[model samples]
Target: MVFEAILYIAVLLISAKLLGELLYRINQPRIIGNVLAGIIVGPALFFLVQPIDAIELFISIGVFFLFFLIGLEEIDLPGLVRVMRGRIFAGSLAGFFIPFFAASFFGLSLDMNFIQAFAIGSVIGASSLGVAAKVLTDLGKLRSTIGLEIFTVTAIIEFIAIILTSVLIQINTSDAPNVSEFLWLFAKMGIFFAVAGLLAVFALPKVFRIIHSHLRAQQVYFGLVIGVILLVAYFAEISGIHGAIGALLLGIAVSRMNREEYLEISKNVNAVGYGIFIPMFFAGIGLHFTTKFVEIDLWIIAGFIGIIVGVKFIGSYIAVKIAKMRPATTVAYGVMSKGAVDLALMLSLLQVNMLDDSLFSLLVLGTLITMIISSVELQRKLKKIVQVKVGSVEIGMLPIFFRRTVSDKRAQDAMSIDFQKTKPNVSVKNFLNSDIDPKEETMVIDDDGRLIGIVSKKELNNVHKKSRDVALISDIMEKKFHTVIPQDYIFSVIQKMNSHHFEMIPVIEPGFSGKIVGIVSSKTLLNLLAETKPPNPSTKS
Candidate 1:
């Protein structure tokens, strides 16, 4: 079993890597590679590539790990709250409520019992954090304010979804309820929060200190963390809550532990999740699709999907607009990207046999369609919300055409390095570790190795298309970058950053540029202006 599982993962990984690299060239998220692969192997369309149970187990592990990373990478709590409290917050609510209520209503219309209708709504109401995050990542806007806002809202909504899922599952039972006693559910929540609190207040510092002090058996520490996840999950299951809730609690508990360590763990977890567990989860979903949509009345399934998505989109759009979010257009459109939550809820329902195969497939289909459309809309229109301005500005002024250039110096006097200042094949990993202050723009020289252009943080972030995979100095270094000659004067750069509001400006020689060599940054310029005494008039004028 283990061997088969290992082989299955190995194949998927290799395949994902190849396709991922290919898609990456076109600026697509790597997750797309994995998800598309899952769909291809899924029973819905392709029944030939049957993944075994062992493979399914791997996929489950992947899902847990993926969420673990999300918890690790979640937004600043305060920032998240602020964004959620505003228009984005309103949009999230509208998105959740509209779909939820409408789905419930539709289920009832389909002659499903009241309990079933409510369950259906709950499942449809959940949003897809994975899909949303991946879309932003692929667009290279995950770090932007708008992306941050989206990710934050989706996370909070998921938390609510978890609680609702609990309520849906546990409370739906007959008044007596058979599994664990009623109090167990409440107790588990209490225990989780208590443990999470204690871990934050005391355990976290102590554990990190021990790990740092010992510096040995780092792997053992990771092992312990995994154990913590499993244990919490086990106890939660025993106590009547789903294992995923335990996973969340456990993630929260470890949230503040060493960031680097957490990132490392996330990498491993993602491999497992993307390569195995989560894929099986999605594939398992695919396996159950036995032409249910075709068998059922087209109007019934289509109508249900249409109404739920429409309400969500409309409600979110209106809420955002009311709250003064200018960029987000059309509520239904904004809120339509609800994939992860819905999928998770549906999968959970399937696990318990609450939703049969055909219904499950329909939900999957609806989610995929909505997700793709949302991504397209956001990328095309809504993405510009956060980047309202590119350069600095004074309320009213001549916008500066910011440029970079080398100081006006003789060839011999030019600031030069002993080592060849040519582009280096430095590793991306090295960039993370090295003091290559991305904010400090530097010009790249040509073969004669003369100054070409400058590179800025903003420039680095803009390389979505794969002109170069190596981050090779030559490939990525902006040799054709803008600049200001040293003789250009202060007002020129100010106008540039002010009107254009550039982060850094390359200072160069007037018409003498070979390669950019100097920078006049906005911060530095502001400081210089503040510190420098105004030049005395030549004739004491």
Candidate 2:
């Protein structure tokens, strides 16, 4: 058994990586590859592996880590609170209810009982926040207004789905519905959240501070984080909620405190989750695929797929349109990209025997199809609509116009020539007294005219007031900063500038000379935007 487990893991990892790379090359989400890896290795194909107890345990841990990492990366509590408004709430309701009831009614037509149908409907109703986030992040729209609205809607949907799922689980376990059981489930859930919230607000901060101060080893610190995640998960399960919810809550809690430290530690967490565990969890789903669904009607399967895809798209479109949100098409597409929560719910139902293997496989197939279609479609559509321009170069249709702009317009085209340059040896007082624009950042150069560092006006102002003695420009200038070459694409440069929050970036000439050419600032970008018109709908490619 031990040897077999090793072989299973080896095959799973290799297949996952190979398929993931293949999908990535084809411009699809690598998650599709991970799921395909499971189907290839499991009973649907070779039957080379089985979902044994040990393997299942590893898969469960993988799922916990997957949700934990998602919460860490995606959920911005303060931001979400700030963005919550009537349109988002209305849009979320429309997105959630439309598919949910449509799927439920379709399940009933297929002769499923109330509990079974509702369970399946809940799975279909749940959207994949992770998938939508990935799509938005790849397209550089994660921070945009439409992106934030999508995120807000999905976060609310996931929370609602969790509550519905707990109800479903309770219904599945009981022989008949009882008032006490329903009340107890809700009570337990409420109590768990209240306690978790208190710990998050009051205790977790001090605990995390102590851990960071006392622990020197990265491994030990990471372990502590995982321990907290698992402990919360355990409490959540005992309190009759899903463990994934607990993990997500813990992630949000950690996110709210000490952002700088969390950012550093998140690298290690992402490495562990994506590098090993998350892929395994996805692959594990594919492993359960079976070819023994001959008794299940083909029409039922087709109808399920159609309903899942149709309702989500139309519902989101109508909702956003009625709410009068701008860029309605893009918002709809963003909402249509569902995440892994639906799959998680389906698996839960399967585990409890609320859903049969045949039905589970059908739902999984629907999910895989929608995920692939939505991701590809969203990527293609976003390229056509998202317009970014600098100077005379149009970057509205990226990758398509990428090469044209690269050859026609360089970083030098967008760079501001009217900027101050100074030697590192100059005193802060002397530099401030010189006739230079105080609003712009001062570039520090070596004796050879090569760009070395930069000092913002704010830093200079603080130094001027605090320092009893004179300080060199080198003493205050930031040494580590991003620099673009003159030959680089204007679009790529803009992306870097936006991501790093750099108001202005230094553009250096390529080759051994490495001389500072000029700088590109937000003012330059805004000028480009003013000159460029929106893409014409008739001319959209």
The best candidate by lDDT is 2
TM-score, cand. 2 vs. native: 0.71
Task: Please provide, for model 2 over 138-200, each residue's C-alpha lDDT reduced to its tens digit, 9 standing for 90 to 100.
Answer: 878777656666777777767667568767886678777788887887787788878997897
Model 1 TM-score on a 0 to 1 scale: 0.64
TM-score of each model, in listed order: 0.64, 0.71
Point out where model 2 deviates above 4 Å. Answer: 78-85, 388-541
Any runs in candidate 1 off by more than 4 Å, and if so which?
1-36, 49-52, 75-88, 172-184, 215-217, 330-335, 382-386, 390-541
lDDT of 1 by residue, 1-541 (tens): 6776666566555555565566556544444444455555455455444567766565455445545555556523445566665666766676667777888888888888766788888667766566566666766767665565566556656666666776667655546654575566567678866866586447765775676568687667667666666665676666666667666655655666677656766666666555555645554444454566667788978876786566667755665555444344622344456654466667777767778878877777777667667766765654433242224511111111111111222222222232123344543334434666443443344444355644444555565545335565556665444556655656555555455334555554556645455556544553333233333458563
Taken over the whole model, the C-alpha lDDT of each candidate is 0.57, 0.75
Best of the candidates, TM-score: 2
